[model samples]
Target: MLNETKDPLPVAERVVGVRLESPLVGAADLIKAQEGRASKAFAMRELPFRDLVNVRGELSDPAFVAAFAGVVGCEPPAAPNTVARSDHYDVLWLGPDEWLVRSLAPVQTGMLEAKLTAVLGDAYAAAVDIGSGNTVVEIEGTRARDVLSRGCPLDLHPRLFKPGQCAQSVYFKASIVLIPTGDDHFEIVVRRSFADYFCRIMVDAAASVAP
Candidate 1:
């Protein structure tokens, strides 16, 4: 009899049986506690499972710019501390040649990275799916900026840090990518490891300043 062999299942198939949880899965009660004060001053909540892709390329190259814009619906913001927004994505400037592309809506893991890679074919660029590496926390209300100002050193005055702008900064001990989505609203992109600490600390800060 001929020897028989079988091909192993793909990594994706093998992992299909796994269950995923948000980094802030353990902070449900903490978040609920803050919800009571949400209507008054500020509220904090985790926006989990967002599709985050880190893209890097030289914008000076015509091919790179074209390829990126083709896929992202806009050229990467060349200006420091700015964000390029599309109907489906918000491209936040992380460096002169690096950006974080965040989907406006959640998507199947790897779906965004695959689309970006396909469109940027052979270009001197990279698209990495870092969705599982971090989580987004939204803090909004009348006192949202006040709560952030407690730990963040940036001057959040409207004339200084308005909507459509982003900065890499720290919230107390956690390194965060801060985005101003509106006058009194902000989104913080923090590493998964720090999600718990960041949320707990933020809630405490908000309570101290609660009206």
Candidate 2:
């Protein structure tokens, strides 16, 4: 049917915005939100069966470096982004004198820690399990960098933070180790005692961003 045609003014589409489920949402929902929306979310989850091994030997010792390389199966003088990984373990260079060895499985962590401590005898180094003292917070989504920048002083631009990067820094007025899990995700390692406080600060900060 032919009607008087008047060009209708363009109407802006009223797109529906997603409502955040809740901070108490399930893991499945959390994963879904991260995949769908470009929202940053942090979950303070209990990470079981992990270990932190620190090498205490002098950095200048050639024999020590060779022995470490033998066990780690990688060069001691590591270049940037140099990470040695076994099936269940990963060795990350923290500095010229320090490095962090971590593992997911308890047996794997125990075996590796014992092996390294034994291999690198009293004269070589020490390996202590400090896993009990820390808490792990998994953060994900596109806004992850901005959420972290509120508390951290480091430049988190992707160009500076490549994958597998970890650094010790001030997080919400507490010291923590920030590990990049992906391009838009990170795992924040904080002390166990300060976990509750850390979570509270993160919750408040996230609310502002999410709103």
Candidate 3:
């Protein structure tokens, strides 16, 4: 007689009607295991599975700005290349009519889209989820600037790139969005396709100094 066997994997769990299982990692993880960390100089890690959305709307429109501030839980930046920061989210100004909204908490993409759409009725705007298409890498430590300057030409001096500043710059060959969150601390947003290449570049740059 044959006996039935049970599955080894744990059943998927859910919270608030959302699936909370099927764990995943970011593109950088593929090389994270093999790379020699520059911890002595700079520490690096991928901030995967974040709530990142592309926002395009007219800031001149009061209704549009109001709708955006409502959902993001913070007001949008009026100046160019600046970030409106809060404990839960950050609104990054990319252009006169474009912005990138990154939420600290993981959220439902569809639900967030729906909420924004509903609030922006008759307003010319769009909220597109790019979480699956890109990821963020945080690098910070004593020698962070040296590692970044290896490929990036931006003047990342503390006097020039203090907290609350963001810019579009190139790293190696990848065009990335750079945000300085604190002294020697930065967040880089890169396309999923270029993530692997950039990770390798980061490892090489970090190797120059020491761990």
Candidate 3: tens digits of C-alpha lDDT, residues 1-211: 1112443433332223443321124433644653344455688877766778888898789999899888888877878889997677898889989888887766654455667778989899988877767778888888888889999999989998878879999999988999998888899888877887888888788778546
Candidate 1 residue-wise lDDT, 107-150, digit = tens: 66667898889988788999999899899998888898899999
Candidate 3 residue spans exceeding 4 A from truth: 1-31, 34-38
Best-fitting candidate, scored by TM-score: 1
TM-score of each: 0.91, 0.68, 0.82
lDDT tens digits, residues 10-54, model 2? 322211231322222334344444445434344334454466666
The candidate 3 region of ten consecutive residues with least summed lDDT is 15-24
Lowest summed lDDT over 10 consecutive residues: which window, candidate 1?
Answer: 1-10
Q: What Cα-based lDDT does every candidate model obtain?
A: 0.88, 0.62, 0.77
How much RMSD separates candidate 1 from the native structure? 4.9
Scored by lDDT, model 3 comes in at 0.77
The deviation in Å at residue 148 for candidate 3 is 0.6
Q: Which pairs in model 2 have colliding backbones? A: none
Best by lDDT: 1
